[model samples]
Target chain A: DAGITQSPRHKVTETGTPVTLRCHQTENHRYMYWYRQDPGHGLRLIHYSYGVKDTDKGEVSDGYSVSRSKTEDFLLTLESATSSQTSVYFCAIRPQVYSGNTIYFGEGSWLTVV
Target chain B: DQQVKQNSPSLSVQEGRISILNCDYTNSMFDYFLWYKKYPAEGPTFLISISSIKDKNEDGRFTVFLNKSAKHLSLHIVPSQPGDSAVYFCAASSPGAGSYQLTFGKGTKLSVIP
Candidate 1:
């Protein structure tokens, strides 16, 4: 298994509140990604980082932000929580080596907005 | 519109039987395909992958077949076990598309009955 850890495995927040999910990896991977999984939607990328301080938005970047100051840490923040944002968020890392472009994922963070 | 589609929402198979999950993509630029397995309340794990240059790739009990001409891919699990019951997602990407992003399908739930 990849040495990826997501903080606050589960959380419940009220609407309009701020929420931040942290992803820490010990593998020293060059690329990191944040994705959300929902019923009927599967996993949608929110943001990803290619290197330290280099990040880009993904398909579902609305209302969410990400920052990566170090190679081992990637953070995803929900500026204002919404009911629609409730889903399981997963952090993934891709090794620099060619492993058929495979990305390993963390356990997951469950978030709920009421 | 969804670029990657898994038309079947769910499938069931008896233990020790073969389980097949299908996926299709509309984008012609996609050259890399992958399959992931996920259980309830957990992150998705990479299962298998196949490059466009190859038509098939296998690992142990899992085999991935890609048909570039049809823009379709399928995952086959031989002698499926109850523990193999989970949601399977198919993803595709184009290395030349700029970012290291993968478009995923809605996923198919596989139920392996005893």
Candidate 2:
């Protein structure tokens, strides 16, 4: 609840279609992260940004792209959605870039690709 | 290749009893760990965290124990209530350089039965 908001809280798209999820934060935290939560998969990091325009791929970065042109916004896009990509997406933020920093998350976006 | 692992997929505890969730990590380099809780349709919320420098940290009914030697961490929730039903994830991170990203476990779904 750290002033985070994820647009399109629910989205349903067909396979082969492009889908984008937006995460916005007012906390002005320097570290932002995009994660996907699937059954039996917990929460896997997909992409993260240390700063504006400074993004890095996570363990499950494949088939996904991220952009952070502004410090308050991070975007995750799937060029070609697949049924396997259906999952609840979460965006998290940390005030610092250290492991000890406390992280906050948005409400999340539920995406279903049929 | 999974640095953090939650071996238990689910757990059931009677209300007012204690609940324990376990997590393991394969990386000794991970200097810090965190526990997060999530209910369906909502994003994960930070529960408790402990650093490698400490063995235990407690907050209210939640306590986190970190055993660096075996690379294991556990979260204990006392007086579990029906509202405590949710999926809990154990996440780890190594401090240094430019990384605030956390590697999360698959998670354990805990149900507090009345």
Candidate 3:
């Protein structure tokens, strides 16, 4: 509840342009994730970071990349925007512990590739 | 294949009644299950969760039931109010104590009529 924030609440961009979405966490959690929500797909993970300078691909990592320079911030970048990538992007934080590991999501950023 | 599935796309219930939302999963390895509520323009908020070790977990007016044998779980909201109306998502993850990632259902839209 006290931990996550996403930038650019809403954005409209043309195709072929690059876009970057940012996620910031104050809890200093070790794990951060990026996900996209579509009409049929509830939420699909794009990429996640386990620690500073450590990141991994997820189920839907195509055309998306992520970086974590610091423990509190993660950035998801789209090299070339397309209509297919247009959706509500969400940033989440999950602790390393599995038993009590709960993931909290950001408010979400709506990106439209027109 | 999709491990998590929500058969119902939407449900409507009268205010002050029991609202039950169902979810099914194909994965047997999932031990941690969570339910989330999402309103318009907001991220999904954690509502309740039940572990595979337990058949049921309750908090306030919300209760979650997990049936390991059937690979099914349901969320019951007693005395539902208009404020309870929102899209409900069911998420599941493996029980291992490591970097955990969640798979979510398509979500069920619950409309509580006043």
Candidate 4:
């Protein structure tokens, strides 16, 4: 409903393979973030971008990487995916800057590594 | 250490009753708190939020109460319906750090029985 879309909504990949997930938004929001959800972990941030080409690592950025080339597109890359990395990934955007606006999340992408 | 925590893993409430969910935070810097609801196969949606300056904020049947002294927050849903059953997550952010730095709790599943 927020005009956010995540590609490859469901995918099963083998271990040691490379995978990338794309997030596209039509709202033109400046801040975009990638988060992973696990059973015991609510949501852990992997990476975030404040503006095009500006990215920062989050608390759980060990094996993941992200890139933002345009205002509407943010990409997350998992190089040599591991079984431990299997989880549901979500992309979110903050509606405004310097305000207490709520962040909207896109339908999650489920990834499985075997 | 986990900054945000939701002690209860699940809660059950009868229809038309009240459902209360609790969250706690360890960081004193957190000034903004948010509650999100997630149904199966979809992303978590923003439900309500409150700032540290206020003790309570209400929106329709949903109310969020903040106890700054105790570093705790709770969400109440009156006249709970079956549609209200879902996983609820509590998130906290420091206003100074902005919204992208939100820390989320593990979440509590709510079941509204008819």
Give the DockQ (2 decimals) of all models: 0.77, 0.76, 0.78, 0.73
Report the number of clashing residue pairs per model. Answer: 0, 0, 0, 0
* CAPRI-style quality class for the chain A–B interface of candidate 1: medium
* Model 4 CA lDDT for position A107: 99
Per-residue alpha-carbon lDDT of model 4 for A1-114, expressed as tens digits? Answer: 667899989999999999999999987899999999999899989999999999989989998999998999999999999999999999999886454847889999999999
Place model 3 in a CAPRI quality band: medium
Query: lDDT of each prediction vs. the true structure?
Result: 0.93, 0.89, 0.90, 0.93
Q: Which ten residues in a row have the lowest lDDT in candidate 3 chain B?
A: B93-102
Against the true structure, what is model 2's DockQ? 0.76
- Ordered by TM-score, highest first, the candidates read 1, 4, 3, 2
Tell me the tens digit of each residue's lDDT in model 1 across B14-100. Answer: 999999999999999999999999998888999999999999999999999999889999999998999999999999989775456
Candidates sorted by lDDT, descending order?
A: 4, 1, 3, 2
> What local lDDT does model 3 show for residue A52?
98
Error of 2 at A25 (Å): 1.3
Model 2 alpha-carbon miss at residue A83, Å = 1.6
Q: Residues A32-76, candidate 1: write the lDDT tens digits.
A: 999999888989999999899999989899999999988889999
lDDT-wise, the better of 1 and 3 is 1
Instruction: Write model 4 residue lDDT over B1-92, tens digit each, in one string.
Output: 99999999999999999999999999999988999999999999999999999999999999999999999999999989999999999999
- Candidate 2 per-residue lDDT, tens place, B1-114, comes to 778999999999999999999999998888888998988878899998888999999999999999888889999999899999999999888876245678889999999999
